[model samples]
Structure formats: C-alpha cells, structure tokens
Target: MWWFWTLWAVVALTHCSAMDRNKDKALKLMKQTPLIDGHNDLPWQIRKQFNNQLSKVDLNTIQTTHTNIPKIKEGHLAAQFWSAYVPCDTQHKDAVRQTLDQIDIIHRMCDAYPESFMFATSSQDIMEAFIQNKTASLIGVEGGHSIDSSLGILRIMYRLGVRYLTLTHSCNTPWVDNWKVDTGTEAPVHNGLSPFGKQVIKEMNRLGMLIDLAHVSEKVMNQVLDLSKAPVIFSHSSAYSLCQHKRNVPDAVLKRVRDKAGIVMVNFYNDYVTCSQTANLSQVADHFDHIKKVAGHTVIGFGSDYDGVRRVPKGLEDVSKFPDLVAELLRRGWNDTEVRGALGENLLRVLKDVERVRDSLTKDQPDDVPIPYEQVENACRTNYGYFPLDNTGHSASQSPLVLALATLLCWFFGGSSYSCRP
Candidate 1:
C-alpha cells in the first residue's frame, strides 16, 4: 500500500512538472515576439453585422466578434490585414460600391478608436502603430472580381488605400480560370490572363499594389508572377504538398515565389494545413515544418483565413489563440528572429517591394490612350492557348506510373493519403 502511494505521488509530480514547463515556454515566446497575422475578416464581420447600420452594435465595445480591440489586446496581435472580402458573383449591381462598403468598415473602426487602431499603408506606418501600442490595420481586397473588369476601378481601389487584391477567389473572373473550376476538361477561356488581365497586373504594379495570387489557378499564379514587376504575396494559403488542397501552394510554386523574392504566407485553415477534415493542431504544425523545409525562412509568414474559413486548427481557434501558435513554434526550435519573420517582417518586406514598384511606375507615363476592351479581349484570345494540361506548351503532363507510385507509397507509409474532404 505504501509503495502504491509512492508511485502515485511520482506520477502526479511528473504531470505538474510537464504543465509548468509548457506554461513557462508559452510565457517566454509571448515576450520574445509580436505575432502578425496576414489575413482576418474583422472588417467583413463588422460589415456583416452592421452594414451601414451602426446602431446595432457600438464599435467601441464590439462584444460578439473573434477580433476586436479588446480581443486583439488579449491576443497580442501586433498587426493584421483587415480583409475587404467581396464575394464573387455577377448578381451584385454595384461591385465597386460593395467593395467600398467593406473598406468603410475599417475606416469606421479606425475613426472609433484612434488610440487602439491605425490604418497602415506602408511598413513604416505599421511600425509606428506598434510603437503607439496600436494594432496596425491594413486593407486587402479578397477578390479581383470586385473591380468589375475595369482598370479605372482598380486604380480607384488603390487610391482608397487598398494594398493587395487577390487575383481570384472561388469563382474565376472573365480574365482567369479559377483552380476550383478549371479541371482541364474544357478549353481554357482566359488561359492565365486575358490582355485585360495583363493590364490589371500592370495597373496593380503601377499603383504599388501587391498582386495577391491566393485562390488563383496554378497557371494564373505562374502568369501573374511572370508579369508582375514587383514581388507578389500569397496572402492566405498553405503548403499543398502536405494536404493536397487546391487552395494551398505546391512546392514548385513555392520555389518560384522564393526565386521571385516573394512571400508565401502560411494559412491556418485546417483543411489547408492538415489532411484532416476537422481542425487538428498537431497536423497544422506539420505544414509549417514542410514549408520551412522547402521555402526557407525568408518566404514564410502567417495568413490565417479567420472568418473566411469555417474550421480552423484546434489550438488556433480565434485571434486570441495566436499566442498558442507562438508557443508551438518555440517548441519546434524556432528562435526569436525566425518567429518574428513568420509573424510579420516577411510580409512587410513584400509590401515594401510593392510600394517601390508603384513609385517607379508613377515616374513613367504613357501618352497613348488606354487600350479598348475589344483590343484587350482580342489580345487575350491569342493567349488562351497558354492553359495548363491543355495542348498548350504551358500545360503540365501527368503520368499513370507516377499516380500508381504515389498510391503505393501512401499505402506503404500510412495506408491513407492526404485529402481535403471538408
């Protein structure tokens, strides 16, 4: 009986030691660095609840949202892009108006609490916000479709302080085939970009806007990267090699992004990070490890699709749980510099490069009238042959043997292959 008591005491003491270690590690990580999330829909959430109806909830004490002044303070979220997510659909009569409304949400938040939040267009602004103990609120348009296929509208958005524009969302625009829809069955419509799309890239480059390729097809991503004068940003995406999700960036693409001096912000959606259909924290870490192995430290950052993704990694449920991620990285042997880069510096570098490109373009002006829509479409028609997996030289070829080998390897290793079921 006495021996049994001794064994129980030893087990209890071991458990307490383990808990204490985890706590200490978490505290150390929080003090070492400030976490910067690349994407969140705090503005979208605000718009969804109070779309021009400010009476519904007080902006000062927004009680019922994942991200707010109080929650950001609690989470230690030093900076984040308050995404201006406009859903892709032709049904909206005024796409630009809708986009403007989303932008207004951020403006309202900044106006309500100048001390706690500040709108940041450049890296310097972000740093200043940090110095002031304010969360730097940056803006990014979720879909290119918000511009209504007009370069004028794109310029207007840029002038309105929109920094990044996701080239495509779930739906492919008239100028690009979406990866979700482009299954290599029918002939590619826009291939990667119509001539109009090229103009869009040029305009974005000219405006210093970071051409976001997140949600675009692989072919589109390649074309945008080829055309953009500045480094690009994958605002919200993960490693496809780990989970095989269509939304995640593959190794080959990641390599090109690195070569282009671009940054691929790691996503936190469970489906993208892990093979699991549900949120799983451990599997999410695997994605970070895989991306680090392939892309190196320079190319990694966070792009948590908060409010955009229904399910998230278990430990990273909301903005408040960001500290948990910092702790996880520390456990994985990441030092302060590496953690800080992953959190925000890497993304800031891309933003600065975009600004430089914009500045260069502003210095060069053309006298020729803007190309007509018909001529743009005609130019794009010729490029449709650039479609992937099509007879076009750009298409990737698949081999049956490779598929067979992959199946065999999966069975041999774990008897299950990574799939994005949810």
Candidate 2:
C-alpha cells in the first residue's frame, strides 16, 4: 500500500514537470517568431483614459490598462492591429468623423512612442518592426459606418495606412446585417450584403485593405468569402461551435475561411471563448484547438480582442499574459511551427496575399464614386415609403402630407424613385 502511494505521487510530480517544460519551451518559441495580434483596443482605452491624448498616458509602465508598452513587451507581441473603433450609435457623418479621430490617435500614439512602437502598413513593415525590437502598429477601422457609404472614404482610409475594415459592428450597416441583429437582438436591415455592400468588398481588394468580418452576420461572411479577391479575416472572433455565441464564427464559416486561405484570429473575451460563465486561460486554448481542427492549422491565429471586451479570460487579463496561451497550446501537443502560425505566421501570409491582390489591381482605377445618401437612408424603408420627421422630432409614419410629398417626389424622380406600396 505504501509503495502504491509513493508511485502515485511520482506520477503526479512527473506530469507537473512536463507542463513546466512545455511552458518554458513555448516561451522560447515565441521569441524566435513574432506574435501578431489581430486586434487590440488600446486606442480606445487611451481615448477613455486620457481623452484621446497620448501625453496624458504613460504606456511605459503599468497604468490600469490591459495594454501598455511594458505589457506588450512582456506578452511577446510583435505586431498589433490597433482598432480604430467608433461606437455604432454615432451614426453616419458623426461616426465617420469619430473614426478619423480614432485613426489620428493611433498614428500619434505610434509616433509618440517611436522607440517602442513603429507604424506598419504592410507585412514587410510588420517584420521590420519586429526586427527593430519595436511593436508594429497597424490600423484597422472597426465598422463600415466609418466610410459613410463612400468608396472615396474607403480609399482614403487605406492610403492613411488602414490595413483592414470590419464590415459592420454591433448595428447593421445600410448595406449589411451585423451578427448581433441577425441573432434576433434587432431587426436586420439588409438580410445580408446588399449590392452596395459587395461593392465595398471590391474596393477593399483594389486598395489592398483586408476585409475584417468580425461583427458581420454569417450570410455576409459567406457572401464576402464568395466575392473577395483577397483573403479576409475575422479580426477578433471565436468558434461558435465552441461557445455558441453569435459573435463567434460558425463551423461552416470556418471551413470557408480555410478554403479562402484566410485566418480567423481567435477572440479571448471570456463570454465568447467559453459556454460556462467562468472562463479560464485553458478555454482560450480550447478555441484555438477547435479552430485548428475545423479550419486546419494554417488558418488559425490570435486576435485577443484585448481592451475591447469588458471581461477577459482569467490568466489572460492583459497583453502580458500571451505567453501563457502559447504555453497552453504547447501542453495540448501543438508543435512549435503550429504554435508559431497561431502567433503570427498565418496572419502574415493572409496580409501578404491581400497585398498581392492589391498589386494585381494597381492598373485598375479607384472605385471613388460615393453611393448616394438618400439611397442608403431609404434602403430599409418598408414598401419603398418613408416617414418624415416632424418638428418635434417624432416620425410621422402615416402623415398624408408626407405621403403626398413622397408620391410627388417619386413621380418627378422616375427611375431613381421607388414605387410606394399600399
């Protein structure tokens, strides 16, 4: 009996020792290869903390934030797609202006910390930033609303070094339904991508900007996979099969992403990563495992969604804890190469492919024309009829005067006017 007890203790000790060895091994692997996180909301954090002023925040040390210069270094983060996120509630023109402010903050933050950060607009730029021991700062606009139905704005965003643009956020864009609305939280505006939404993808390909499908409905995701000339990404999403969250990517979508040779960078938000309320670091690894199994190892990567979500997985509460995830993957039998791919290689490959598509389109002129404003506004009007806003700000859904005016306008406009249904 004593001998049996001793043997059990030895077995447990050996298992612990093995875990330590794998964790150590994972850390070493991260140093050799860069860990390019697809999304981080530090720019928003700065907006909240310092009112969009970089000087008010000291990133060199711990400062009540998930992402800081020191935390980024500790996490082995080589490159980051800083989210130029503006709330979807800030509609149309205001959303566009706020997005510009977010972009400006990102550029200034990178410039303010030149020694610790360097701006990266291309895959090569990311690698160069890594080589220089600086974290690459790549910009990713969070919603299509930022462009305000203007292809010209999209082109300008890309020229300003924006590498990716999420097709929608929590709310549906005029041309696309978002995941949240499609999940029944709200009425969907465009059941999927409308004609104009497809045009957005084409312009993105022409400009070399990666189409981020994080917050879009699955219908939109499938539509994009079918139409995009370049590989697309889900900048910060998890596997819906694992957690059943609407914010997560479905299995069917995962396979499509793999077929496109694109990547789905896993999100680390506790709610998205796990079905259980208590999310641990291991659950984060579980998402990586599930995506790799369903999508193949080539298309798996990390997006983290750091500073974006209110609750992060335990042990991955900040950017500094990234090595912990790498260690978990190693413990789960992932090889150094596969681990490296999840860390950054897969995203690099996709970004390079997007750039190649853009280069192929260099001779093509920009899709610079703006989609007409009234067309966007009336896209969801029932029976092609709209309710006019009264002086007190109430919508007059059945005003005879409004209906008569709409009929008169339709008669004069001809083809541009939609026929009002009874």
Candidate topping lDDT? 2
lDDT per model vs. reference: 0.74, 0.86
Residue 231 CA displacement from its true place in model 1, Å: 1.1
Worst 10 residues of 1 by lDDT: 378-387
lDDT of 2 by residue, 1-422 (tens): 99999999999999999878987887788878899999999888888777897777778874777888888888989999999998886654367778898999999988888999999999999999988989999999998888877788888888899999999989887788888876688887777898889889998998899999999988889999999999999999999998998989999999999999999999988889886567999888998999999889999999999989889888998999998889889989998789889889999999999999999999998775555445665422322224466676546654656656666766565454433211
The TM-score that candidate 1 achieves is: 0.81
**Per-residue lDDT value at 207 in model 1:** 78
lDDT of 1 by residue, 301-376 (tens): 8788887777887777777777666667767787767777777778878888888887777776532234344433
User: Ten consecutive residues with minimal summed lDDT in candidate 2?
Assistant: 378-387
TM-score of each: 0.81, 0.87
